[model samples]
Target: MRHQKHIIAVFGGREADQKLLEEAEHFGQLAAEAGWIIICGGKGGIMEAVCRGVDAKGGISVGLLPEAKDIEANEYVGIPLATGLGYARNEVLALACHAACAFGGKYGTLSEIAHALNNQKPVAAVESWKIQGVHECNHAWEAFEWIQTQLK
Candidate 1:
C-alpha cells in the first residue's frame, strides 16, 4: 500500500536572508511542478516566497497561520488556515506532511524539523540546521531531488 499525503512541509525562517528566500522560492516552484502541495507556517519571509512560486505555477499551497483564529485570505496561498495553535502548529504541520524541505531557519524551523523526524518523515534540507538526521543539501535542486525520491 502506498500511503502518501502528497504534502511537503516547507520550514524556514521568517527573517531569512535574501539568498535563502530565493532558494526557498525556487524549491517551491520545483515541488509544485512535481505536483506536491506545499504547506508552511503562514507569515512572511520564506513562507511568502514559497507562496509566490506556488502561485506562479498555479500550484496549491496551504498556510497554517499561528496567530490567527480565523483564516485570513491570502492572494498567494490557495488555502489559508488559522490554527490558533501558535508554535504548537508545528506539530500539526509535521503530521500533515509526507516529507519536509527546510531552508535556513531559526528555532521554529528547528522544531518543525524535529517533529517531522519524530513522525518518521524524511527531511531534505538546504542551509538549515546541522542536526544529525537531516539530509543537508547545498542547494534547492539537491534537496528537491532527495525529497522526490523520498516521496516515491
Candidate 2:
C-alpha cells in the first residue's frame, strides 16, 4: 500500500512563552486542517500547544519522543513513537517531513533547524529568534504558507 506524505514537522523548545504557544497553535490547526500530519517533540511548550490545537481540530499528530523509557509525551499527541536516541532523534523527526516550522526555542530547536536545512528540508520560523539557514517569519500563517509550498 502507498503511504501518504506527511508535510511539516514543528520544532521548538520544550518550554516557550505564551505568545509563542498561541502562534504555534494557530500554525498547527491550519496545517492539520490542510490534511497535514503534525510532528513534534511530544513534550511541553510549543509542542504541547501545537498538539493541542491539532487534537482540537480532529487532526493527526505524531510525536517522536526523545527517550523510550523515561520520556513523557504531551497530552495531545495522537501517535507516539518512542525513540531511545534522546536528542539524536531530533534529526529523525526533522528529516521525516518535507518541511519544518520552528517556534520560539533554544539550542535544541536550533539544532533541529540546522539538521532540516542540511538534510534539504525547507524550514519556516514563526517567532523563533534567529536560527541560521531558516526562512524567518513573524506570522504563523506566513510560515504555514511557505511550508505548503515546500510540500507541493
Candidate 3:
C-alpha cells in the first residue's frame, strides 16, 4: 500500500509585504521538506511565494485559480486549476486540502479560513486573523507543526 501525500492549503493576501511573503515561502519550504504538497490561490503575493518555495524544493504546487483563464496563475504554479468561481473558489480550495495555513490577509483570506473551519478542516494562522477556532502561531514553522498535528 502506498501512503497518501498530504495536501496543505496556504491562504493569504495578494498584496502582501516582503516580510509576509518570505514567511509564506518558508512555510511552503518546510511543508515540502516534510513531503507535503501545497495548494494556494494561484495568483501573486503569498501564493506565488509559497509556490516558488515548493518548486525550489522539488515539491508539487497546485493553484486554484478564480478565473477561467489559465494564464492568471502565477509563474511558480506547477498545476493550475481554473475554477472560474471568482472569489467563491476559496470554498473549493479549502475543501480539497487536508489542512490549511493562513498568513496575513484581508477579507478573502479570512473567508477561506472560515470556510476551512466550517468544513471541519484544521487551520493554523501566522500573523493572520485571531478567530476563536483558529490556532495562532508566531511563524510558519509553528503553523505547519500545528497543521501536522491536526492532520493526524
Candidate 4:
C-alpha cells in the first residue's frame, strides 16, 4: 500500500508582526521537509509566510479561499480552492487536516482550532491560544515537533 500523506492546516491571523511571520515560515519549511502538505486560508500575513516557506522547499501548499475568486489567494499558494464559504470554510480546513498548527491569531483561528479539536484532530499551537486541549508551544519548531509526534 502507498503511504498516506498528512495534511497540515496552518491557521493564523491575516495580519501579523515580523516575528510571527518568521516563525510561521520556519514551521512551514520544517513541515515541507517532512513531506507534509500545507493548507491555509490563502490570504496574507501568516498564511502567505507559510506558503512562501513551503514553496522555497519545493513542497505543495494549498489555499482555501473565502471568496469565489482564486486570485484572492496569496502568490505563494500552489493550489487555490475558491470555496466562497467565508468563515464557514473553517470547517473544511479543520476537517481536512490530519494535524494542525496555529500561530498568533484571532477568533477565526480559535474557531478552526475548536472544529479540529471537536473532530479529535491533534492541534499544536505556537504562541497561540491556551485552550484546554491544545498542545501549546513557545516556538514554531516546538509546534512542529509536537504535531510530528502526534501523527505517529
Q: Per-prediction TM-score, please?
A: 0.93, 0.93, 0.96, 0.98
Candidate number of the best lDDT: 4
Taking the tens digit of each residue's C-alpha lDDT, what string does model 4 give over 1-152?
A: 89999999999999889999999999989989999999999999999999999999999999999999898789999999999899999999999999999999999999999999999999988878899999989899999999999999
lDDT of 1: 0.87
Off by over 4 Å in 4: none
- Per-residue CA lDDT of model 1 for 55-112, tens digit only, reads 8888889999887654443457778998778899999999999999998899999999
Q: What TM-score quantifies how close candidate 3 is to the native fold?
A: 0.96
Q: Tens digits of per-residue lDDT for model 2 on 1-152?
A: 99785657999997878888999999888988998998988888999999998998999998888888535988898888888888998899878988899998888998888888899998999878575678899988999888787776
RMSD in order of candidates: 1.9, 1.8, 1.0, 0.7
- At residue 78, candidate 1 shows an lDDT of 77
- lDDT at residue 113 of model 1 (Cα atoms): 96
Candidate 3 global CA lDDT score: 0.92
Cα displacement (angstroms), candidate 2, residue 18, comes to 0.9
Instruction: Estimate candidate 4's alpha-carbon lDDT, on a 0 to 1 scale.
Output: 0.94
List lDDT for all candidates, in order.
0.87, 0.87, 0.92, 0.94
Pairwise TM-score winner, candidates 2 and 3: 3
Count of backbone clashes for each model? 0, 0, 0, 0
Predicted candidate 3, C-alpha RMSD = 1.0
Clashing pairs in 4: none
